[model samples]
Target: MIELLQDAHFWVGVALVIFLGILGYAGVHKIAWKLLGERGLKVQAQLDEAGKLRAEAEALLVQIKAQREAAEKQAALMLETAKEDAIRLGAEAKVKLDEQIKRRAALAERKIATAQAQAEADVKAAAADLATQAAETVLAARIAGAKSDPLIDAAVKTLAQRLQ
Candidate 1:
């Protein structure tokens, strides 16, 4: 036992045990454990914060996607409305054009009727003049060397009655 007590390795081991006991009594291990626990809590808090930020980012992405879809729908509706308006305008223009064409055709027909009426009047007047001249020639040839005074008096009386 005396030889064991004088051993250098045993003395070193005893010294180490005494040092550890003194540290325990001084509360150094407790302080180290508390610091390690606080560090672990801080890391956990950071991880929770990161998770919250990631969730917020995902929510924002969903909101942006919804807004984009709404905008696309609005644009499509506007495009459809524009197409409808264009078609309506085209129909209205065609109606107006058809009305104008019909009006022009009616006007042309009226003008042609007036011209035909005028032409008929002119032809009738010419025919009447030619018939009167032919009758005058036949009368002059047939009554040659006849009683001119009596025939002239009778024709004047007949013309006066017809005029009235």
Candidate 2:
């Protein structure tokens, strides 16, 4: 190792290393600052875009607040309208129910009147039938003891034929 260090090849290697270091520094570290100017331009553009976005966000916030208030007002109005509609509907239902009750009462009264008329007609028909049956029975009893059987049969047969 000490022999290599003392050799001329070692000095040549040192010279090459020094030249590469100078080349790297000169390329990477520029004094003209073109890269610095580009970085500054990029930063300025970002700041301008940020300022524009901040303004837009503030405008959006204002619009959102206005929309929220408008929506709240509309909801309140809708609720009020619904309440009024409910009240109106309830009143209408009451009116319709009252009308229905009156109609049903009238129909019931008519049915009751019809039933009474029918009952009176039935009673009259039953009374007439009873009178007819009673008259037939009384006339048959009066004629039964006085009449001869042959005379009665002849007379009854002739009367039945004539009636038919």
Candidate 3:
């Protein structure tokens, strides 16, 4: 036993035992365990925060998708309304154009009829003037060869005025 105590290996073993005894006496093991438990709790809290943020992001995404669908539906409705308005306006324009064309044609016909009536009246007046001149020439020739009577001369003057 005295030889084992004097050996270098036995002294190293004794030194290692004393070092471990000092660490145990100081409660280093309890401190290490407490630090590890605190680290695990911190990690768990971070994971819970991450999970809450993911849930919020998913909710926001769903709301955004719903809004997008509503916007698309509104856009389609507006487009359909615009198309209907265009078609209605086109129809109205066509009706107006047709009415204008009919009115113009009727006005043209009325103008042509008036012009023809005026022409007929002018022709009639010219025929009456020619007839009056021929009658005056025949009466003058006949009266110059006949005897001059006051009653006949007055009647001949009144006949020329009545013909005109």
**TM-score for all models, in order of appearance:** 0.58, 0.57, 0.75
Order of all candidates by TM-score, from best down to worst? 3, 1, 2
lDDT of 1 by residue, 1-164 (tens): 99999999999999999999999999999999999999999999999999999999999999999999999999999999999999999999999999999999999999999999999989997887676667666766666656677767578556544533
**Number of clashing residue pairs, candidate 2:** 0
Pairing residues by index, what is the TM-score of model 1? 0.58
Worst 10 residues of 3 by lDDT: 148-157
Model 2: per-residue Cα lDDT over 39-153, one tens digit each:
9999999999999999999999999999999999999999999999999999999999999999999999999999999999889878866765665556557677666577765
Q: Report the number of the highest-lDDT candidate.
A: 3
> How many clashes in each candidate?
0, 0, 0
User: Candidate 3: deviation at residue 53, Å?
Assistant: 2.1
Model 2, stretches more than 4 Å misplaced? 1-41, 134-164
For model 3, residues 1-164, the per-residue Cα lDDT tens digits are 99999999999999999999999999998898999999989999999999999999999999999999999999999999999999999999999999999999999999999999999999999999899889888987888889878887788789889888
Model 3 Cα RMSD, 1 decimal: 3.5
Q: Which lDDT value does model 3 have at 94?
A: 100
Q: For model 2, where is the 10-residue window of minimal lDDT?
A: 155-164
Off by over 4 Å in 1: 1-41, 87-92, 133-147, 150-164
Candidate 2: C-alpha lDDT = 0.84
| Residue pairs clashing, model 2 | none
